[model samples]
Target chain A: MVAQAAWVVLLLLGIGLLLQNDLGSRLALFGIQPDLLLGALVLLARRMGPLTGLAVGFAAGLMQDGLMPDHVGLNAWLLMTAGFLCGHARESIFWESSVASALIVFLAALLHNFAQGVLASGFNLNASLQLLLRSGLPSAAYTAVFVTFVAYAVPRVLRGRD
Target chain B: MPAPRTPSDRAAFLLYIFLSFVALGVWLSPFPSPRAWVTGAASALYLPFRAVSKGVENLLGLVVEREGLLTEAAELRRARIGIQELREENQRLRDQMDFARRDSLHLVPAWVLAKRSDRLGSRVLINRGQLDGVRIGFPVIGREGLVGRVDALEGHLSRVRLLTDRASAVSASIDRSHVDGIVEGDPVEGLRMRFVSYSADVKPGDVVVTSGLGGSFPPGLPVGRVRRLGLESGGLLRRIEIEPAELPERVQDVFVLAAGDSSRGWGFLWARPVAPTDSLAESVRTPRVEP
Candidate 1:
């Protein structure tokens, strides 16, 4: 319970920083972003399991939806699916390197954004594929870089606990 | 130890697939507006949060202003000038209110919070919603020109479908020649004015504004200036590219024009005058101008 609480707090803080816009502006030059939230979900899925990851993803997505101006519950649904996919990948594949981790994160982010675009359009929200690509690609690239760092740091952070 | 895969796993997978399909279906389905409930809830919830955030931002600004870092008289004068500019801006908005009233148009001011991140597409979110009398199809305009239309309304939040969306079509004309054409967005960035006759005198740098042909927008709102003009392969119609007068990326505030009911049909304000010479001229010209 304590671990879960800590995780939630950390996730919320990251999201809050991202929502503030000031932090993003400051760190945008270094390509450092608040995508650590996504990285954390991926790592949690690998270490804990799929069900836990699913719950985390849903909660994180809900937080995102609340903070953002887009439709409510959209990100929650997308992130939950992304988390499930990550867990499934972990069970099926033997990805051991940072490069693989980056690739997975990139793919997951892309999928999430694509799902958002599709959903937005389905609702007659006037979203286009070109717009999705322009926004999603860079966001995926940035998330990948963040995930690499998180993947490296996760083991160090969890070494003595388990 | 081998990971266990139970019957439940199979069931869960099936459920997941079904749910995924359902989600996809919801996305594709055209009937129930996806934005109806979600937007309403989000906007309603955001009101207090936005208010709090704005308060905090203003407090921070106040602290910054009171720091007394500007010791020089010149800097103090500059600060006074800035305040005067703000006052003038406030007065201008007040004048706009008067003008709007005189014109018999109702205006609702909305604060923009976020823009669609893609450069090619145009969409924006405003902090006014159903609670603020904003409804879907409300015309959005910035200081200089027409911005877009309210595509979705939640509660206190609404999404503005920018004039640059591919699905967005505005009945606009050259201010000088009054040549009518529809301005549309390319999948790529910027707008393309379509259906202009090859004989039309449209040229680069011609100012384009809403012709008020369609009830969708008001007349005389600046759309953009012509950037390029060319002929399509058919040589039947001229293709004109326009650079939008108002940069969609930089807008912070917009006004929503209330949708008014007119006794006449759409584009009633701009209805073609009866020539009395030809009956067909009235019918052909009328339907063509309806947005």
Candidate 2:
């Protein structure tokens, strides 16, 4: 369990490094970059159950807070909430179909961006909704594209190894 | 799909609430830089990543520098070719200056302004005219040998008909045999010596020069070598083909000798003495007058 948690932290660190580099900006689609961190959270919640999801999500958020201190603990709460909701439905959702898995990631990313915007705007509902309609749409779509491959490959590789 | 409210689930829920409340406390805390410890640990963990980032930046800089160097190399290549041409032109001008001094000749140096060739053969326009002592029938020569004679003149420009022109003719003789013949230009055969009898002692490789018979051209000026020899159809004269002393197409800078007694001792150009036959000079026109 400790090894798995370490892997999760390391993975997020890799994603954070990419986000801070020129190569990451080059991969942006129409000015909206994919949120791979949020996609990983969605995958963790769906596969690892709510308890594990909550702990990992909390740690992920704290790391984010460490990088950006402006919103010190906001990411922790928001990421945990996202993890709980995805894990709640983990037993019911079909994880075999890539399309269904991608859709789940897309919706998760959309809600995550909207929630972050609302909290950042101090609960300004109009600005949060506007963000969801504008940058959030393309950003979620981009994350979905990234997660689709992850969802398809991770399950097969883990199953094959098992 | 809700999991039963087992002991573990209840404990996890309580844990989630505890963590969230603590995060909320920190958000509302008054202390600035409260997460400095967290940020410090994270920065320490990322030390290697920063080094790698710098390496990536340097590699990109090298790529940009490579492209700039390639552009600079292409510009330098073009500049090198232009310098080579200027060097060659300077050498040619130096040789022309030397030739004028060694011969002790009066030469009016002129740059060929324009050149053209057609069914009439070749002609060139030089930037010299009657105002510059450039008269009609004045002999023009490149550093090598006879080029042509000036045919027309303007106030500041004159046209010279090249020796290879169809209407052009000069009295020349073989240097070895001292036999004179009319060297006329033909569009097909470059230069042919007519009137040399079948029994004339002329052979291939013999040097032909101006006999100065018509006094139109200086005596013993390097004309050309006899390339081929044959008998005329009637068996009366020999068919002698003379290669030109100068390639008419390539003459750029030329010197026009002021017409008169200037070419008297000019036979030294071919190491021969003046052997003027005035009887032949009277027969052929001194200056071929044409429009």
Candidate 3:
């Protein structure tokens, strides 16, 4: 249990560092970057189930919140909800199929990005729609494509190693 | 399907989710110290990455453009001799005009860690902060001219509010016309020079420089150029649009100016007499927009 907790903490820290690093800024397109931390949360919760996923997602979101102190727990709330949803879907969804895993990631990214954009826009319906089309949509598509590639490739590589 | 999580796990998950929601509900931040610690740690971790990125960039430049750099160095040597003559002539002109030498101006160089041009405001976080003697309200400038002012400070990071930020205002004047005005940042227009006299001989393409009335910013730093003159408010003030000298988006490395020169008030600009005007400025109902 302690080892698992340590692994979760390290993973969160690593993802948090990537979000702020120079590479993160370079990866930004139209002022929107893929939420790599959220992608990590999806994978973790989908495999470990809701409880572990919820803890990791909340902690990861808290790390983001720490960087942007004014937006205190906004990301925490969003990511915790996102984690729960992803974890709950694991039983119903065929997890072994890479396409199903990719679909889960796509929906999670879409929901997370749109919700974040809406909240940031102060719930202005018109602005929220614009943001969803511009920032939220592109980021979700990008993250989905990235996770899909990772999902298909990583398991095969690990299986070969085993 | 796997059985649902144990009762204890379910309870813990619910509690954590509830706590996060409560945290979002509160406007007041109760975890200031922890947040500060995390930000500081994040900044500290970022330092080495910045160093590595800069080093790799320098290495690539040296490898790819070694001949270009060498040729530039040779060209600079020839330019240096011509520059010395110009410098001597400039000094002679300055002495002839009796302009005070800015020997006391001290500057601290900092790398921009991040530029936040989001909904909140246009701000840049520089690596230098209170630890590096960067005080709030210190004027930050780029190679060509004024970028912004240090708005906030931390241990080793300072947030600068760019002149393009709506909250920003600076004392500025036309270099050729000597017309005094307050330059303000607009969300749409990058910069808008406000409160200039309607009679002032200002036009497009004129260079704007700091008027030094505020004393926080050093006088004569190039602010921007008059892009277009808009007769906004159509009566008292001329809303002259300006293009910032250095685009806030492009600002990377900047110098935070520490004014060694004491407050000169209006004495410096007083050498050249401005057109005396009526006291209608008191009647204008413009909000006192402090930068």
Candidate 4:
């Protein structure tokens, strides 16, 4: 359990660093970058179930929130909810198939990006729709594509390695 | 590997939701919270990583553009020589006109880290912070003119709010007319100057500079030029539009003016009088925008 916790922390920190650096800038699509931390949360929840997923997602989101200019808890709340939902889905939906895993990642990315736009709007109902269409939509699509690619490819590579 | 929906899961979910609301409340709170410390610590940790990544990128770019860099170096060398001569001439003129030298100003130079992606406001992250004597409200200036002021500060990183941000407002005066007004930003519609009396003479092409009335910014710093002038609907003050002198997009390095330094007000611009042949001088001498 301690080893797993350590791995989660390391992965979160690594992703946070990657997101802020030039490596992240090089990967930007229409000024939107992939949310690797969010992807990690989805994968963890899908594999480890809801309880562990919630904890890891919250921790990772907190780190991400700290790095970005937005409110500190915004990412934490969104990612935690995402983790819970993904973890709960594991019981009924088998994400063992790469396509299913990719779909989960795509939906999570879209939801996460949309929530981020909502939070940035400070819950202003007037600006919410505009923010969603402007920043949220493009970011969601870009991140989903990246996350889906990772989800599909990583499993294939790992299986080949085994 | 579906974990069963046990009582523990329900309990954890309830607790997590409560915590999430608390976090949301903290975010909405009017007062500063402890989250700033977390941000500062995380930024400090990420600094080394950022530096290494930037260095690697620079190295890669150098390898890819060796020939281009060589050509750029030759151009830079000629530009440097021209700049050196211009600097000497400027110094000579300043001395000739008895303009106050900014010897007391302690400027902290910093490199831009990353520009913020927020659409609501314009901001850029810089590699200077509390450790470098950078504080909120300090004026950030580029080689050309005013860039912005530091909005948020961390241990080793700071966010500078550009003058083009909608939230930005600066007290300014026309250099030729000596008419005072407030210059404000509209992120979408560009910058606009307000509160000039209808009787005051303002025309397109008039230079605007800081008035130092608010104490937030020093006096006589070049802000922008008047793009257009129009009467306010109220028939009291004229609404003057301005174009910013410095473009934030092209800025790589900026100097943060230290706080509580009143000795660094811009006096260099006063060294030369506005030319009598200037068209705005006639407009300033005679009010053009009638009530």
Candidate 5:
């Protein structure tokens, strides 16, 4: 029950962070938006494994989609897939250090953006390729930086509690 | 030792797939009308949180105000001038109200609370809703000119779809030449005036106003000003670029015109059709007048 409550509190904090405009600027250069919520999902998946991560991602994505003004359900679909991939990757790969974690985050960010771009294209909402390059590349780098810290800390925190 | 795959994992994957299908369905389906109940409930829930945030913001503003008063005297002087301008505006509005009473045009004031979160779309939510006599299709205007029209109404909130939205199109005319064309938002930004004659004498900075072609909007409300004019490669028609009269990003207050028969204010134009009535009767009349 305590763990559940803690997770709920953490989720709320994550939501609050997502709502903030400056949070993106804190990590990203220029106007690119690193997916902060995705970082949190990765940590959760690492600790609690695939099923829990998938559930959390779905709920978070649904909340994001509903609150946002875009076509509903876009975020939910993307985030769920991200969670699933992250969990599957964790089970298969053995990363011993922070650098490896950053590498994984970089690759995941690339995949996430590619998926988003592909879906956007299918919907005919894709913007200029120049815009994608300018925004996408830096965002992935920043998210990788964030994951390095998070990936290092999550395991330690969970182990300490156990 | 490796753990066995669990039932929960299968369930979660199935749930993810179900949600994705649902999402795809929503995206593919015809755009839903704004959910009034959901919006109203959300607005109600947001009120307390907004109030707390506003209180904090106001407190911060007070501190800044004090600091500005002491150090930013020039800025304060400019603000005083702005306040004076506002006072003059209030007096003008009072005079306009008196004129409006005689003219039969009623103006209702509304406060704006939220803007649409979609960057690609242009929509705003006003505090007044169904309870306040606001309905879908009501025209909204800012202090400078026409803003947009109400697209959806909840119990206490209504969404205003701005003229700059790609989905919106307004019939407009150049003030000087009276050339009619349709103004619509480009998917990128700003508006494009289409269907103008190739020979139309349109120029940059020319004012565009609503032509009252359709009963959707009242006549003569300032819509925008032409910023550029260009001919398409095929050269069949002219395209005029326009900057909207209302800045969609900064508007905070607007007026909702009461919805009723538009003919009430258009009586003068209705009178014009009377002149030809007598001539037509003279041409059609025969010896039947004796009967």
Candidate 6:
């Protein structure tokens, strides 16, 4: 359990660093990059339980928020909710299917962006709903593709190692 | 599929909500918070990565956007030459117009250090500051035209609020029609020349320039070209949207015009006789500063 926790923390830090480095901008498709951190959170929540999801989500989101100029708590709020939902869903949902994994990632990303738009409006951050959707939808699709690939390959790799 | 929510889930949700609120509160507060330090540190840690990424992007740009970049570079060179010619021409015009020598004007060159990340706010930081004689309210001009005004000053850096900023307003006139209006910046539309008389003959492609009425910007400096014209809801004033002469993305260096004779540029206008068909009332037109 301790080893798993350390791995999760390491993953969060690595993702945080990568996102902040702006590789996302280079990889942007239609002015949207895959939300790698969000994918990691969703995957973690699916693998772990609700409690671990909540804690990891908060930490990862806070790290992201720390790098941003404004809207410090906005990501934390969104990611926490995402993690919680995914964590709870893990109990009943089977992640063995790659299609389901992609769907989950897409839903998570959509929720994250929609929540971002709502929060931006509340904070008067000048991010319009139209702008949010324009960037968000593509980002969701991109992240979903990556998550699907990971979902397919990771299990096989682990089984091979065993 | 619905998953059963346990007591633990409820408690965790509440805790997360509470933490998020605390963070929100800290961000909203005007006072300094530890969160700023944390964010700054995280950003600092990413600086080397950013530098590397920038280098890689530039390399890729050379490969992919070679033609576009070359075209832009050529355009910039042409613009620089044109600006130099305009500067020399303006010097001669200034000598002819301001024969009385009442105003002292000089340009100070400054490098654009950084651009503000906030999409809503159009501001930039320059390297020149108080030590370099840069001050608040001084006009900053790019190679193309009017860029912005110095909004704030520090020991070695200054903030310039661009003409496209919502708070910025400039007294301007249509070059051909001489219709006077107050130009204001809009985030959505580039710049809007407001409160022109309804009867004023303004149209698309008309050149707009500073009238030098407000003392913030000098007279005769090009601000933008009229892109579109419309009548306001009140119908009393005509609304004119303008495309800013200076493209913010291409602006690298700017000259701060400090204490200049802006009024004297209207000498040519004064020398020309008015046509009778141009029935623009004197009250509607702003008075030109004369020597």
TM-scores for candidates 1 onward, in order:
0.35, 0.53, 0.42, 0.44, 0.40, 0.41
**Candidate maximizing DockQ:** 2
B1-291 in candidate 2: lDDT tens per residue? 244487867766777888888666666667756567666655666656666777887899889999999998998899889889988988898887656654444688998999866665678889987667666667888877788887667667777888888888889999999999988886677788999999889989999998978767878788888999988889999999988888777789999876333333232342223223221222134544332
For each of the candidates, what fraction of the native contacts does it recover? 0.04, 0.39, 0.23, 0.38, 0.34, 0.38
Put down candidate 3 lDDT per residue, B1-291, tens digits, no spaces: 234477855665666657666646532357566556655664564456456667988999888798888888999998998899999999899875544543345688998999878554677889987667666677789998999987666657877889888888889999997898888887678999998877889989999999988655667999999999867665777889999998988999999875333233123432122111211122123323344
Docking class of 3: incorrect
Score chain A of each prediction against the true chain A by TM-score and list the results: 0.73, 0.81, 0.84, 0.80, 0.74, 0.81
lDDT of 4 by residue, B150-188 (tens): 766666777787888878888899999899988887676
**Of the candidates shown, which would achieve the greatest TM-score relative to the real structure?**
2
Which candidate, 4 or 6, has the higher TM-score? Answer: 4
Model 5: per-residue Cα lDDT over B113-221, one tens digit each: 9886354577787887656666556679999788888766666777777888877888889998899999886646578889998999898999999997856777899
TM-score of chain B of 4: 0.53
DockQ score of the complex predicted as candidate 3: 0.12
Q: What is the lDDT of residue B123 in candidate 1?
A: 77
Interface RMSD of each: 6.1, 3.1, 4.9, 4.1, 5.3, 3.9
User: On a 0 to 100 scale, what is the lDDT of residue A121 in model 2?
Assistant: 90
What C-alpha lDDT values do all the predictions have?
Answer: 0.68, 0.76, 0.73, 0.72, 0.68, 0.74
Residues A98-162, candidate 3: write the lDDT tens digits.
77777778788888877776776677778887877887778877776777777678778999999
The per-residue C-alpha lDDT of model 3 at residue A107 equals 82
The full ranking of all candidates by DockQ, starting with the best, is 2, 6, 4, 5, 3, 1
Positional deviation of residue B154's Cα in model 1 after best superposition, in angstroms? 98
Residue pairs with backbone overlap in model 4: none
Worst 10-residue lDDT window, candidate 5 chain B = B269-278
Model 1 lDDT tens row, A1-162? 989876665445444434434444554634534455566677666665565555566656555555563555666667667766676678666667778878888887777767778776774434646755667777778878866775676776798577
The numbered model that scores best in lDDT is 2
Alpha-carbon DockQ of candidate 1: 0.04
* Candidate 4 C-alpha lDDT tens digits along A80-153: 88887898888777787767776788788777777776677766755876766776666666666677677677
